[model samples]
Target: MTQDLYRLIYLSRNTIPGSNENIHQEIEQILAVSRQRNAASQITGALMFNRECFAQVLEGAHDDIQATFERIQCDPRHADVVVLDFKPVEARRFSHWSMGYIGYDTLASKEFTQIQQATGFDAKQFSGERIYDLLHAHLYAAEKAGSGLGKIA
Candidate 1:
């Protein structure tokens, strides 16, 4: 990957239970700062929050992305962050947004219940787009997550 092309991949798990809505407020603040800085200059990526975990891909200046993620980690709203991957990208997979994503609380309802009912699977082991799928089913797009990438990306 070119030096100019770097991506920060990480995860965001919520720390506060029953704290879905508050995460949205935090994200709005983040977006405001990012936009004020110029969306095209410092770009973050996408996020997928399983009811239990979060995953993300961030793209832009290496230091900026990492520092931003650290801020998110310290945010009382989330925790248990595992940075599964980080490095240069041959190309951008989720390159379209300034910061695009959803929070884990997106699954705090019907679909999570159904998954629990159907698979008897404890969410801790779930992965991939599966969590996002559940969130999509239960929440409105607005409630799902707009721009903050929910710290996952």
Candidate 2:
């Protein structure tokens, strides 16, 4: 029998205190580790990070997603971990990416600036679907432009 697919979206304050270069390195480490773990667990997802907050969408089996989120909540780098949405999904939105990443500069672009103005980067203000949509849109645009915006592997 086939396992069911589920999606989880969450936001958290970035508590990795440091200079920009240091923070970037930390995030790169996160992506590197996340890519390895998620791929091993058969999870695919996208992560968006500004210096102040992080929004991510994880898709996989229910148990795997739950386990991953639990680890995320306990992580020292994240503060105010909040799950915006979680439920069964018909399909994976990020099937190709083990862990796609969107950085601060990409988010500061004019196109995304309007989104930031409307929603703000505060983790408390976002809905899970909106976060998923934002990441999906970025991936779609990158694909269309033939750009490797967030592709890690």
lDDT of 1 by residue, 6-58 (tens): 77655555454566566567656655665444354566565555555555556
**Model 1 alpha-carbon miss at residue 65, Å:** 2.1
The predictions' CA RMSDs to the true structure, in order, are: 6.5, 2.6
Report the lDDT tens digits of candidate 2 across residue range 28-139. Answer: 8998889999988999998887767787899999999999989988999989878888999999989888888777888433434455567765545656776688889887
Best by TM-score: 2
**Candidate 2: worst-modelled 10 consecutive residues by lDDT:** 107-116
Per-model TM-score, in order, reads 0.55, 0.86
**Top-scoring candidate (lDDT):** 2
After superposing candidate 2 on the true structure, give the runs of residues whose Cα lies further than 4 Å from its correct spot. Answer: 1-3, 108-125, 148-153
Q: Which residue pairs show collisions in model 1?
A: 56-152, 56-153, 57-153
Return the TM-score for candidate 2, rounded to 2 decimals. 0.86
For model 2, state the Cα shift of residue 118 in Å: 4.0
